[model samples]
Target: MPVKIRLQRHGKKGKPFYWIVAADVRAKRDGRYLEKLGVYNPNTNPATIELNLDGAVDWLQNGAQPTDTARAILSYKGAMYKNHLIGGIRKGALTQEQADEKFNAWVAQKEGQVQGKVQSLAEAQAAAEAKAFEAEKAVNEARIAANAPVVEDAVEDAGETPASEEE
Candidate 1:
């Protein structure tokens, strides 16, 4: 059987959630699978992915070909890099310990980048909310100011007598 790694759509319309799986090539897009590897959620700001690194690498080593989108997902989650390191180890180009060290360092760097993006997104959202609030306050103040003179005129008219005063 030709095993393939692919995504299975699972969420509602307009908002998609996916399961990453290893399956037979003849299977339908969302049909039966050999194993569920992980999940991909693109709804979040950073496009959240929860993957089993070991499982994915095992599949890759066992000759599971990934679809393009699944390939990108695997690459994003470091599975492809881990597989590469394993290949290097198998070829004696690098020791297991060295491959582990490199993979760990790469994961740490990727995490830092993701964290930075999340923090920047939060800061931008906060700034936008503050700006909107300030604009709304300015508009309300203008409306009150525009109505103040009319109110004053009404008060003056109420306090003064009619202009028909006697001789």
Candidate 2:
């Protein structure tokens, strides 16, 4: 029985959520599955993934092939790297402690990159808003200046018209 790791569609139209599952390779795209391993939500700013790491590793070792998108998700979460490290451990190329240390360092670096991106986005949005406010303020000042002389002229004209009629 060939098993596959894939996403099962959920959520409403447009906004999508997915279940990562272990299913028979022959099953339909969103059909029945053997086990629900986790969930994925792409609507969030940074795509969200919830997974059972041990279960996922076990499935991969047992030859459960992943779909392209699922593979990317697994790669992002470091499942693929963990698998590689285990392989290295099995082959005596590296110790488990060394593999864990490398994995932790990689995860920390990835998280820092994500944080930097989020901060940059926030700063850009704030700058755009400040620029827009300054432009609006300038427009208001121009309009006020343009109307001031016209208001003064009207008042002076009204006074002269009454005095000329009296003379």
Candidate 3:
């Protein structure tokens, strides 16, 4: 039986969440999975993905094909790379320790890149909020200045001595 690694949609409309699963290719998109591998949540800024790396690599090595989106997700999470390393190990091109070391180094580098992106995005959002706040503050100060003369005129029209003059 042909097998596939694919996503199954689950969350509410407009806020989509997905489950990564291994299943028969003929199964319905969301039905009859052989294993629940992990999850993907695109609602968050960085588009969160939590995958079972070993499980995914196992499926790949066993001949389960991945859909395009699933392939991208697997690539991002390092399953594809891990599978490649395993293949290298099988072909005597790399020792297990060497393959493991390479995979670990790659994972570390990917994590650093993700962290850097998150930090940059956070900094940009903070700067935008600060700029908006300053503009709003300036507008409020200008409005107060514009209304001051009108307030004084109304006081005089009502024959009430302005508070400053009375004092």
- Tens-digit lDDT string for candidate 2 (32-139): 899888999999877789988778888998899999998998888888888889999999999989999999999999889989988988899899999999999999
CA lDDT scores, all candidates in order: 0.95, 0.92, 0.95
- TM-score leader: 1
lDDT of 1 by residue, 1-167 (tens): 99999999999999999999999999999999999999999999989899998999999999999999999999998999999999999999999999999999999999999999999999999999999999999999999999999999998886664543431
Please state the error at residue 26 of candidate 2 in Å. Answer: 1.9
The TM-scores, one per candidate, come to: 0.94, 0.84, 0.90
Each candidate's clash count:
0, 0, 0
- Candidate 3 clashes: the total is 0
Better of 1 and 3 by TM-score: 1
